[model samples]
Target chain A: MGDVTVTKSPDGVWCLCRLVRERLKAEVEEMKSQFSGFRPGLVVLQVGDRDDSNLYISSKLKAAAEIGIDAKHLRLPNTTTQDEVLQSILSVNQNLSVHGLIVQLPLDSVSSIDTELITNAVCPEKDVDGLSCMNAGKLSRGDLSDCFIPCTPNGCMELIRQTGVSVAGKHAVVIGRSKIVGAPMHDLLLWNHATVTTCHSKTLDLPEQVGRADVLVVGAGRAEMVRGEWLKEGAVVIDCGINHIPDETKLSGKRVVGDVHYASANQRAGFITPVPGGVGPMTVAMLMESALRVTLCSLTGGRRHGNSSGVVNRK
Target chain B: MGDVTVTKSPDGVWCLCRLVRERLKAEVEEMKSQFSGFRPGLVVLQVGDRDDSNLYISSKLKAAAEIGIDAKHLRLPNTTTQDEVLQSILSVNQNLSVHGLIVQLPLDSVSSIDTELITNAVCPEKDVDGLSCMNAGKLSRGDLSDCFIPCTPNGCMELIRQTGVSVAGKHAVVIGRSKIVGAPMHDLLLWNHATVTTCHSKTLDLPEQVGRADVLVVGAGRAEMVRGEWLKEGAVVIDCGINHIPDETKLSGKRVVGDVHYASANQRAGFITPVPGGVGPMTVAMLMESALRVTLCSLTGGRRHGNSSGVVNRK
Candidate 1:
């Protein structure tokens, strides 16, 4: 009998945090030396003080600080009115020092403040979150120049590109279709020349579809919903889902998990990302990159004015 | 052996032209009775004398006239300057009588006029082509309530929905990725909850991918590229391709064909759209529909004045 090759052992998830951190730190130091009083300024607007929102804001601020970017957190009470949020966004938009502005999502869904209206109010130039219709439209049309890509999907793309697998002609299956992650990921993969398939909660044959992927990106936000057995051999798996489940073993009585079953997926998959350290750090890194881009555009007067060529002119 | 049941013959392409035409005519007659001077006025701007563009404009005008809509063909010389085209568009945009304006595509590509710039110059309200960033972005974000969906893809969707197949949970494979048909088709299908896979020139295993689809939409514009043998059993095929090939047998010395091999695909497919009679008529019909929508919006004072609530909140 031909010797059975042992299944390749679990390769450690690519440690992007250190690499991105060092690069950002270097960029910041160089900028400081070249241009005095030049620091990228980012503001995070939060309302209702959700616990998870607080955690996300703190991590973002820490990442910004590490890279020498000035970060501010603007908090609003649960009772904040729509006008109040819009007024704050307008003021921040006018602030020349604020290079990037992000309104933290899930802003009290029960409240009268329309999320879409508030997000659109942010100056497109400073819309670091890239949720505004203008940026989303530009991204959908495959125009990346001078556009801020949403951080999570952008980070996921960076991770997939780092795998050294050419995206062109590859079958990439994305699970989930949220505006932020899944939809943008679909566009990004399509733009990179991948035969992309998007499977959501409505997908009938999830296993069969997932099994067909050369590169599988799961962002369904369900903890460990994707099993390892369904993965194609040598598939590159990117888990964008960050879910927390109760765990008696931890002091906090909870542990973070991704959409994929990491332990099992690691065995069969050629490349897989672990939940906590994989996509989380990369999201922060991409945000820093967005901030830097916005800052540079502001400095160089590359800020797009009204009714210009919105399509990215591909040379 | 039990009777093969003949694998159900290919159903005739849903004749959306007749349906849309009849409905539009009814609406126009009703409007004539209800309000005087309420005819929907559409202006077609042709920058060059392209034969195909001429044919398209004539059909559009014929359709508009049949429905009591005022249609004007504004022919610009091939030597028309960019400013002249822009000036014409601006005048048409300001003309209160004109509800919709479309600049025929491939308008003197040799000229200094940038197609993107020219198209973007049209007021989004009058952009019946729906190629503007505003409409494309709104469509991408799944906000279809107030957006003018690009005609061809909208027609394709209308045909598919007429097939009585629920798009949700279907594995829809779209061949082609052009901004006009394929890209928008992908978004429309995705919005309808289909697990959509976009296959283009970069697709390596076209046969395998096509075989996996329960619903296949082909718009590669190549003459009969997809064969029946490659299709999944009982798959519904929507061919958006319109390609011409020389045939000595015809007096015109040419015949029109689709991206799919009709003879072979019709044998195995449960539903198949014929080339000349399929998506082409639907495209014209949808264009008329777009004009009517814009006109009604204008008459009812639904004209969006500002950036407030871009999402079309249908009453």
Candidate 2:
């Protein structure tokens, strides 16, 4: 029997992430020299200090520091009011020094603050997280260059690009519909010229759908829900799910896994991304890229202001 | 073999359109009684007088008049500049009497007027055509109740709803991605809980993809492109393409057709919409409905302004 060539792409992701950061660093340095020490700034707005949120924020800050970005952690008390949160966001929106803003979500708050209102309050030009309706609309309508795509999907696309698999005319089946991951991923893939299918909890015969994918991206929160048997032979799989399950083998008592069953999927897949070493690092990396892009556009006076472009250009 | 039921839906569309007009008439009368002879007004701005544009405007005007709406045809000269068109649109926007406004598309002008700019200049609150990015953004985010959906897709959804087929969990294959028809149709279906696959010219194995659809909506603008043999048995098909092909048998030397080959499609489809009489009439009806809805909301002070809702609620 001919040997199956299953390419595991953890190293590929690390290299890609490193290269992006390096390019961003070089660009940021050039901008600083040209604009008289104009340092690109990003503000991470957190409603509460949950340990997980803190961990995410710290990693973002670390990446920003490495890229020579002015990264600030705007942490609010858990007992903060909705108006107070909005006030803080509005203040950041007006801050000339801050070019990018992201609200660390699942707002751990005593009071029920509206997350949508808070995220949308971030100026669209400064919405590096790309969760605002304006950015989401632009992305949905295939206005990729003008809009900020959500970080995780952007990272997933970058990974898919690295696989050297041409997305055009290929069937890409996305097995989630979450705004941050599945939904945006579907849009990104479709705009990239892939025939895209979006499967969700309501989807029937999901395995059948998955089996037809030339490229498969899964962000369904359930750990190891997608099986190896369901995947098409030589399919490129990008798993975005980060689920922690009890593991006696690990000292931390739990280990992170993806939506796809890695060992089994690896046996049949042509290219597969491992959970911890794959999409997670790329998501953080894409966030830095988005921040850098937003800063460059806004500071360089190339920002588009209310210019209406028709979303339907494919016809 | 038993008889295959093929429900041709031209009658249903006519009935739906009439009922909607009746409902709108009654509502306008009620509003007039309450607010001192207040009448809902709609403004259709036409830049130039193309024969098709004139025909479309006349139909819309006729529908608006039937609904007791104060319909005005703001026809500008063919030599009108982009700035002049913008000025006209902005004037209509500021007019408190005008509750709904639509710019008749393909602005047949001597100057190369920006269609996107002209369409978007109509204030979102008064944008009955629903071509504005603000409305498009809201619709994409599944804010169905708040956003004005583009007329054609909204009409198609109504037709599908009339068929008594539950969209939720069904496999819907949309064969085009035009903003006015296919793209919005996909979004509407996705939000309504259908698993949607969007296929365009880039789609390989198109027939195989078509065979899997429980529900199929085609707006590819190609005359009789989708054959019946490719369809899933008893699929609900909505054809939005209006194309004219040469027919020697007809006196006009041309006949209208849809994207689907209707004669063959009728044999397999449980429900199918016919061209010229199906989606065409419904689009006009939906435009009138949208205008009425916008007027009711704006004049009654129920319109929402500048609310930032995140598009990703599916998680």
Candidate 3:
């Protein structure tokens, strides 16, 4: 047997994230200059005082501000009525200046308003979160022309493409089936001509199925559920899951980890994304890009008809 | 090795087709009886004299009639302008009696009419073919309540459910990526919680991929492209392709064949559907059902708010 060495190279997550962010920032600056007094606006609606939700909202707002986009965070009480929240969404949707709208997830579990109803309330054109039935439907139909793709999945695709790995003809395995991530990811991969297999909680023999993938994307939401040996050698791994686990080594006694056991995956995978530095940054960047796109479309009259030619080249 | 008996069961294409047809007919009859002088109407728009298109239109019209629905076939010349076709679609869409509209496929290839534009022109409420971007998008988002699913994929799902096989957690491999068949089929399977893999022309090692499927759905539109050994033992095969191959033994010099080499597949697959008898009959049955659904919705006044509850339970 010949001796073989597997080099564990960094997947360049930070570099790619910076590149995407810088490009979006440049576009935002250009748009501002092209149209005097034009500022891309985003309204984020948050219900309840959940710490995590507040944290996410602040980060999103900060990111938007950094890119020279005006971001508004609308906070609602946990006991707010369903109609009240919906009315707020409708008002924001009607605002000509507010080009993008997002309802922070994990609303009070007991809230009377249905999550789906609220999601659909946002205007499709300005739905930066891409959770509306209209956007999801457009994405599924392989019509990327006017739809806002969900941020995390869009980011995952961007990262995968950055690796210079051709997605077409590759056996891609996606683990998860959430409407926000797994389902759309599967659709995107299929649209890109990758032979895609989706695995979820119901999937039996997960490891065996994952082993077949040349490109494995795990978003099952469980921390380190996927072990190293489960992945095929030389596989391109993208982890979209972010779960906080107790860690004695950390000062805060907690650490963020992905669905994959990164150490083990790194040993075998040709490319593997780290939990904190990888998909998280990309998600925010994609959201900024989506917001900019909506703003541009609004400034130039109604929705742009064909594929997204302005910023995100889906093809 | 101990002697073991493996009984190859009949896929029951005819039985399932008849069952679905009878149910749809019953629903149509019930609606007719409940609402006096109410006749569900369907308009099929065919843009060419293609023999295959003519055959499909006739079959659809006949099926609608058998179910107590009024159907009209609008034949347009090959030289018909795009504007004329769109105008026809818009007129039929506005008709109060017309509950279903289908633009027959393979519209004159040389014609300048854009198929996508024409398909989208049909009111989503009356688009029985489910080729409209709106219907396709809704179906992809797992929101089946209001959208009409594409007939072939709906038929394939119905057929799979009829077999008494549990689809959840099963590894399903779908061949082809057409918007009408393969793409929607993948979405339906994924929505049903199956581990779905979509293979297309770009796919390498097709046979190996096929071998991994517990359920294999082929719609590549090629005749006998998949052979027996490619399938996993005891695999349930759903062949959606309908191709005519020249045959010396047949009086017509052509015989209908599916994407799979049926004679060989039958030896290994636990259940296998035949080309002519399998998915063909179900497509017409599904169209009749879709028309009835639209008719019922109109009678009830406007689109039904929730999941399809009356006749077609896509779930």
Candidate 4:
């Protein structure tokens, strides 16, 4: 028996947690069937060993191994030249054995971010991360006819749907405009029929924007960046931030929490995904799903089992 | 020559409009110079005998020819098989002379909307219209790295920017989810940093969605679909609809109006782009622009004009 609401209209209950588990089960089985012996390889390139980035990669590699995927964490020194990074990416892109490639961000930056150079060599086919600008544009236009949507944002949607919030016709506001979360979140919401507003550092009156959202996804890293009073009544809240702030009572002297103050925000939020068990784990799981999807797609004539809503052609 | 807003932001008014105009003028002239005896070509595959579709195709062909772009309209009978229709598209798609290809919509009942088939067959490099699903996704994800954005929607944004409304950090609501306008408009808005919402027939409380928009774009076929009372104060409106409504004053007995009740909406709108002269002409113009862009892109190492804002360096 599931504790969440039925798979129809989201009244007052959240069930996406169960749905996510079910989907992971279904995808694992389906992918296994499609990929009998075709093990996929994932190359995660991280520059300058940031502790958080190291932890994220380590977890991703662990997830990959658990899912029977060949995953590697390619770490380079902070002093590594841009050409060296590009050359390493070129090899991963050119390697026929690799099915998915992801370059971890927050690259040792002093100048402008050269997204073009970093992702330039990534072949569109094995670009499971969808960091490539080409894929970003593809998702924006809903021309998913040949693009890998970024996994985390894509996973966020998948997780939200589990709570049974029908995205169609809803007003969704995504906080933060990072390429990884906010930008792609805007497109995904638009694709699913949610009227989307993306707020960032530049947006005036962030609270006013937040107040209008029927579905609010917060990804800004600052602790409790969104106040409880700003949330709309009965809104579905997805907290994607994993931040560490000093908490005097805690043993480690710091506590991890999401961008939204969950306790105060929960009074009005009809459905909320928790921090430690919420988007953090779902992201890694979804990347596995994407790697599997890449393999299945490369195998089966490009049409997936649940492609589109299958509503239009029913008539 | 410009009506600068003197009340709120004095430091902001720096002949920005004139400066942008000068830059665009130089770019346009630069593009025109590259046309040295280059004959652009557009091939249209029109299935069935729908009078409206034919008229639309003919006008596009005329526009193409007027611009020194060779245009051809091929008529395939209603009874033509899907394969035959597809083959005709292939011929145009493969021809090096045909730089742009458009398959007019509403193909007869016999030929299912195999629009996808025709679009898929056309090479991405020559997909000047950007109707291909692959390119559409690229636009949606805010990645213009290697894809051509859709013509009509691209035009809508240019017209909106032309109105002196800054899209960055504004709230924009787009009506209709048609691939042509609503979808691409949403992507363009996201790319420009406006929080965007997309509404369609399935949307609930549509007026509430419209009221939140700092920028409103209406493309639905229904006349007077958007009410003037729902508009936000000082909002900019762009009407893409071309509905024929009864007008006793007109000699033909009817007149063209947009999705919004224009006369009433304009009272509330700060700057509104008229349906007849506003976006309609620009759509055709953008198609020419797309053709120009793709031609230049194919010209080995040919860089777009000095300010190719089209590029998405997502770092």
RMSD of each: 4.8, 4.2, 4.0, 6.3
* Cα lDDT for residue B85, candidate 4: 77
What TM-score does model 2 achieve against the real structure? Answer: 0.93
| Candidate 3: regions farther than 4 A off | A1-11, A248-253, A299-315, B1-11, B109-111, B248-252, B300-315
Clashing pairs in 2: none
> Candidate 3's C-alpha lDDT?
0.81
Best by DockQ: 1
Estimate, for each residue in B63-160, the C-alpha lDDT of model 4 and write its tens digit: 66555566788888898988887788778778887777777776764756566666767776677777776676556555565567677777777666
TM-score of model 4's chain A = 0.85
Error of 1 at B40 (Å): 1.2
Winner of 2 and 4 under DockQ: 2
Rank all candidate structures by their TM-score, best first, as comma-separated numbers: 2, 1, 3, 4
CA deviation > 4 Å runs, candidate 1: A1-14, A302-315, B1-15, B301-315
Q: Give the per-residue lDDT digits (tens) of candidate 3, residues A1-315.
A: 011122234447877777877887898889878997689999989998998888888889988888888999999999988898999998998888898999999776445778888898998878888888767776776776667788888888887776667778889999997888898888788777788898889898899999988888988999999999988888888999889999999999999899999999888888888888788888888888888877877878756332322123543
**Candidate 3: residue A103 lDDT (0-100):** 94
List the pairs of residues colliding in candidate 1: none
Native contacts recovered, each model: 0.74, 0.62, 0.77, 0.52
Q: How do all the candidates rank in terms of DockQ, highest first? A: 1, 3, 2, 4
Q: Write the per-residue lDDT of candidate 2 for residues B153-187, one digit (tens) a residue.
A: 87888778767787889999999888788878888
Model 2's A-chain: what TM-score? Answer: 0.93
Worst 10 residues of 1 chain B by lDDT: B1-10
lDDT of 1 by residue, A67-177 (tens): 999999999999999998999999999998899999998896446888878988998889988898878877787777646788888888777766677778999999998
Q: What is chain B's TM-score across the candidates, in the order shown?
A: 0.91, 0.92, 0.92, 0.83
